[model samples]
Target: MAVHVAAIDFGTTYSGYAFSVSAPETDLKDVEILSNQIWNSGTAEVASLKTPTCLLLSKDRKISAFGYEAEEQYADIVLDGDTEDYYFFHRFKMNLHNNKNITMTMVLEDVRGQPLPAIDVFSLSIKALKDHLKSTVEIKNIKLDDRKTKWVLTVPAIWTDTAKQFMRKSAEKAGIPRDRLTIALEPESASIYCQTFPSAGCRDIVEIESRYMVVDLGGGTIDVTVHEKIPNGTLKEVTKASGMVVAGLRLMMHLSNFSFAYLADHF
Candidate 1:
């Protein structure tokens, strides 16, 4: 049986999945990203390769929408002034990063100030993504089977053991078996992606044997890594992964607030 490689980036502000059918060693160019790329960014519609990491749940805790659909539906609910009943969560992945002692019993606060079990919040989000990913695999003529596929899940490198374990269990609850899933560090993955497609603009500075730094600014966390190119076109980390784990999201929020304030003052 042939095994296909699939990766799910359950990010803080967005989440999406991609699969590669070709062998990484032999056929490296047959990777495909999903075309379901349009999203409603609250004010306007936008196209993106990934969906917003937002989830809308009914009063009874059943998921009503996810990703872009969740964003639009939640916005409509807010406009209708009935936002108190529905639990809408956006950028909630940071909760794990903030808490060092995460557990199944820990409570998570939704955007509406309502609380739910952290496990329920994370697991439901993962399940939603996994189901959508399964549909995409079927569309690509690859039947879903745990044994015949390898799953790669991305997580921030600075997350604690408790946080990582929570994500692992959430994946298991989302129908991804322990044997088929592997957790990858987000910064390392980004480094690999960059190396796979080095920018022509920086080729002169990033030539063979050159050392460069990677500053990964994710939705919830920021990480920096220094890599040295090897003779075989591979990169090795020369410095320890370092950076503030909770800086990117906070910085983005501040920037957005500043932009709004600037517009308000001018108008």
Candidate 2:
């Protein structure tokens, strides 16, 4: 009996939310998905569907800002000579996977290498996105009843059950009811989305009986899934989901290391 479905994608490098409202009789392909596509980057000419994964905390540990606003706020804080007290975090989502021994008590370091409870950081970030989405729905004049809304959170398929549970706990701590939240695998979601394409646009690609692979090259992880379309218009996984940490962020780290090594050797 849900009136709308909202999905949050907490990416390593960026994060965003999307939602759709449709009648039960409406065609899946006809349902219009709306997302936060006007993320402000301070520069008037720069806007994107997702915002940078960043957070800024005040001296007392309260959330000051998030996303692009967090970056701009931290920059101003630095100029004001009060940067020491604030905590700024970016690209911290990878810590959940990088730490093989992740637990509820895990801690994550901020940009200054200062440690804070990982659960707190994650919950706060999720809360920010959740609040933003609520505000957007209100602005659109949509009557979104929290009790009647379905929330979906996406995670990398390669994540361990513990990591996935951690996300669930974080979402709950962020005020999302446990029963209302559904955890979805990134590549599987992609496959489902592909299924909605019209035959002419996706003929032989995702058509019935077609076999294909979905490679989700994300910021912190890369996931691959093979699927086969059944005659009933459903996709069945043909193989186990697998992935690695060698993705966009990791490549950037390698490039930075190479640059440093080159400078050390030449100068």
lDDT per residue as tens, model 2, 1-267: 435988999999899999988887788889899987589788545788999889898878788999999988876766666666888888878888888998999888775566889999999999899889989988988876666788999999999899999999999998888999999999989878877754565557566789888899998999998899998878889999998896667777556535533433343
**Candidate 2 residue pairs that clash:** none
Residue 200 lDDT in candidate 2: 62
Whole-model lDDT values for every prediction: 0.77, 0.84
C-alpha RMSD for every candidate: 5.1, 4.3
Which ranges of candidate 1 are over 4 A from the true structure?
23-43, 202-209, 230-235, 245-248, 251-267
Best by TM-score: 2
Measured against the true structure, the TM-scores of the candidates, in listed sequence, are: 0.81, 0.89
Choose the strongest candidate by lDDT: 2
Candidate 1: clashing residue pairs, number: 0
- Write the residue-wise lDDT of candidate 1 on 1-267 in tens digits: 454777888998888887766545554434543433344565565777789888899999999999988978876776666766788777878888877778879998775468898888888998888778788768768787766678888998878878888999988877788999899988888777766655876664346788888788887888888888888877778998887766657777556545533433343
lDDT (Cα, 0-100) at 188 in candidate 1: 83
